[model samples]
Target: MSREQVVELIPALRAFARILCPQPENADDLVQETLIKAIANLNQYTEGTRLKSWLFTIMRNTFNTRYRKREREVIGLPPDSTNTLVTQPDQEWSARAKEVYSALMRLPDQYREILVLIVIQGESYEDAAVICDCAVGTVKSRLNRARQRLREELGEAVED
Candidate 1:
């Protein structure tokens, strides 16, 4: 991918990072790490492929790696340090949006990733499958399960 093309995807990368990392600073750090890995491994990138999906795959892998590391490191630690104070939203829509986001965050990583890739980022099933390194049927199944879990988390009745 050209330098310009990679630069243009920074915003999208940051948005995805934010979803993966709830803290804004941590999200920015993840984006920076993703960029570093992508640039360092530029030779591995195939020409004529979707650069966005490639970058996303890198970001996802990076996040997963870091998450697993943190899980191991946090054994028997106090939970207070992980909690952040959130301010209440002023507007009704903003409150609703925050509620939805909270529910989304409670989902397992695979489910959340699929939802963000397909529903939020608007990636097609094929592209999402490529980014997620899974088959198209797997992606669709994950998306369906993610939606159902999200709705359940939000106290909504599941339709069939």
Candidate 2:
């Protein structure tokens, strides 16, 4: 892919990175690392392949690698820090967003990743399957099950 084409994909790449990472700075680092790797490995990218899917695969792999590394060297916050971090609800939307994000975090990685791709990021099932390295049918099944789980977690009635 050309540099200009890669530039065009930045917004979508950043959004995907954000979904994988909770911290803004970490998400930014992931995006930067993704772009660097893409640029360095540009020759491997075949022409006519989906560029967005390619970038997303790189981002996901990068996140997985970093997540595993961090898991080995985990850090702990000070004991009293948790109490200090609690905030009174300043707005309804923010509170709701927190609840939804918390629920999303509780899901299995497979379900959460697929849900973010298809439901939150608005990617079609085919495209999501490509990014996720799964079959289209698998993406559909996971998305359906993920939605059902989310509904249960949020106390919403599941329709047959």
Candidate 3:
């Protein structure tokens, strides 16, 4: 991929990386690593395949690798529960966004990743499914389940 193409995709990569990693520095590193990877593996990418999809796939794999590393160092963190919020907003928005964020963080990695790709990152379901390596129908079903579980966790407060 040309430098220009990589530059154009940086913002999207940033968005995805930011969601995957909490710190700005960490997110930047993740994006940087992803860029290096995408470039290095450029020849392996199929011409007709989506570049953005490939980029996201790299980001996801990188995030999982990092998470595993972190997990080995410490194990006290609660397993990401579908009911925990992943939304964030220490100020403004309300505690709800943070609550939502926590719930999102708690969700199963598969469901949470799809939610971010489709809902937070605004990628198409097809793109999300492609990046997620699942069928479109599976993506839809997971999204439905994620939303339902999140709503159930928030209960009536989410409706207000």
Which one wins on TM-score? 1
User: On residues 40-159, what C-alpha lDDT tens digit does candidate 3 reach at each position?
Assistant: 988888877777888999988887877535532333345574222222334565677878866776777677778888876778999898787889999999998888778766663454
Each model's lDDT comes to 0.82, 0.78, 0.75
lDDT of 2 by residue, 1-160 (tens): 6899999999988888766765555778999999999999999888998888888888888888885355223213444554323221224567677777668767877899999887767788998998888899999999988998888888789885
Candidate 3 stretches with Cα past 4 Å from truth are 71-93, 157-160
Off by over 4 Å in 1: 71-82, 86-93
Residue 66 Cα positional deviation in candidate 3, in Å, after optimal superposition: 3.8
State TM-scores per candidate: 0.84, 0.81, 0.76
lDDT of 1 by residue, 106-150 (tens): 788788989999876889899999888899999999989999999
Q: Sort the predicted structures by lDDT, highest score first.
A: 1, 2, 3
Better of 1 and 2 by lDDT: 1
- Candidates 1 and 3 compared by TM-score, better number: 1
Evaluation by lDDT, superior candidate among 2 and 3: 2
- Which residue pairs in model 2 clash with each other? none
- Number of clashes found in candidate 1: 0
